[model samples]
Target: MEIQKTPLKDCFILKPDVFRDDRGLFYETYNQKVFEKITGLKIDFVQDNQSVSSKGVLRGLHFQNGEMVQAKLVRVVKGKVLDIVVDIRKDSETFGRSFSIILDDVEHLQLFVPKGFAHGFITLSEQSIFSYKCDNYYDKASECGIIYNDATLALDWHLPKEEFIISAKDLELPSFEEAIS
Candidate 1:
């Protein structure tokens, strides 16, 4: 697999080596030993979550706080999305910095989103099947988020604001500044 580092301290874009033949294609999505050898991080993903969203569906800029914080290996299973992550680690040099990438079935790319970051995605195809492996189990009381359209962050969703179909909860999330405050 090819591991590409993002500007964010511990974020990465991983591309697995694909083997194709006349009948099908195969790749190792995750191998604990190889993953640890290459990334130098030992991750034990306890939960595997998948979601199906229609075009324009914007999920979040969300994270879990304290001991509930999660590190995720996210990818697209059937379509495409604009995946975004922000470093929210207060003491880190890259805190408040954001990164974006296109995750789609075609390229089979995956993003490694570490803890201390807010992550979100917008469906870019007619529908998208997004999946992720999380290192920690979720805790509702520890759930936190920043509004996707926070002016301070000024992230480009690659679509018009009117086209985004966000949940009322996400729409009401606090701004970046408010979230860190």
Candidate 2:
């Protein structure tokens, strides 16, 4: 497995060594020792979540701030998606900056979105299954997000604005300017 850094501070892209054969394929998705050795940060994931979305569906720019910060390892399981992460740590050099990547079943690539970043994805295929591991347990009070189409962030979700199928809750979230710092 190789853990590569992303443009944002404390975040990374992890690529596992996939072995293929006549039967099928195999790979190790998580190994605590190797991850800590490579990134120098120890994580104890407490939750695993998965969601299915159709093409043109946009999920988030969500974060858990305050006392219950959550870092995530996100990947595509069945199809393809445009994954986006935004740095929200006020003291970091890359604060407010965003990074985008293509995460699909074919590549089996993963993104490590650290505690202080907002994470989200847009489905690019007919149907996509997205999975993630979270370092901390859920805290409803601390969960919040910047609206996906925040003008300041200027995220290009691949699909046009009118094409998106967003949730009513997501639509009601604050813009970047109003997001928690």
Which model scores highest in lDDT?
1
Q: Where is model 1 more than 4 Å wrong at Cα?
A: none
State the displacement of the C-alpha of residue 127, model 1, in Å, after optimal TM-score superposition.
0.5
lDDT of 1 at 123: 98
The clash numbers for all candidates, in the given order, read: 0, 0
Give per-residue CA lDDT, model 1, range 1-181, as digits (tens): 8888899998989999989999888988877787788889999999999999999999999999999999999999999999999999999899999999999998999999998999999999999999999999989999999999899999999988888999988989999999998
Q: What is the TM-score of each candidate against the true structure?
A: 0.98, 0.97
TM-score of 1: 0.98
> Which ten contiguous residues of candidate 1 have the minimum total lDDT?
30-39
Model 2, span 126-157: residue lDDT tens: 99999999989889898899999898998999
Instruction: Score candidate 2 by TM-score against the native.
Output: 0.97
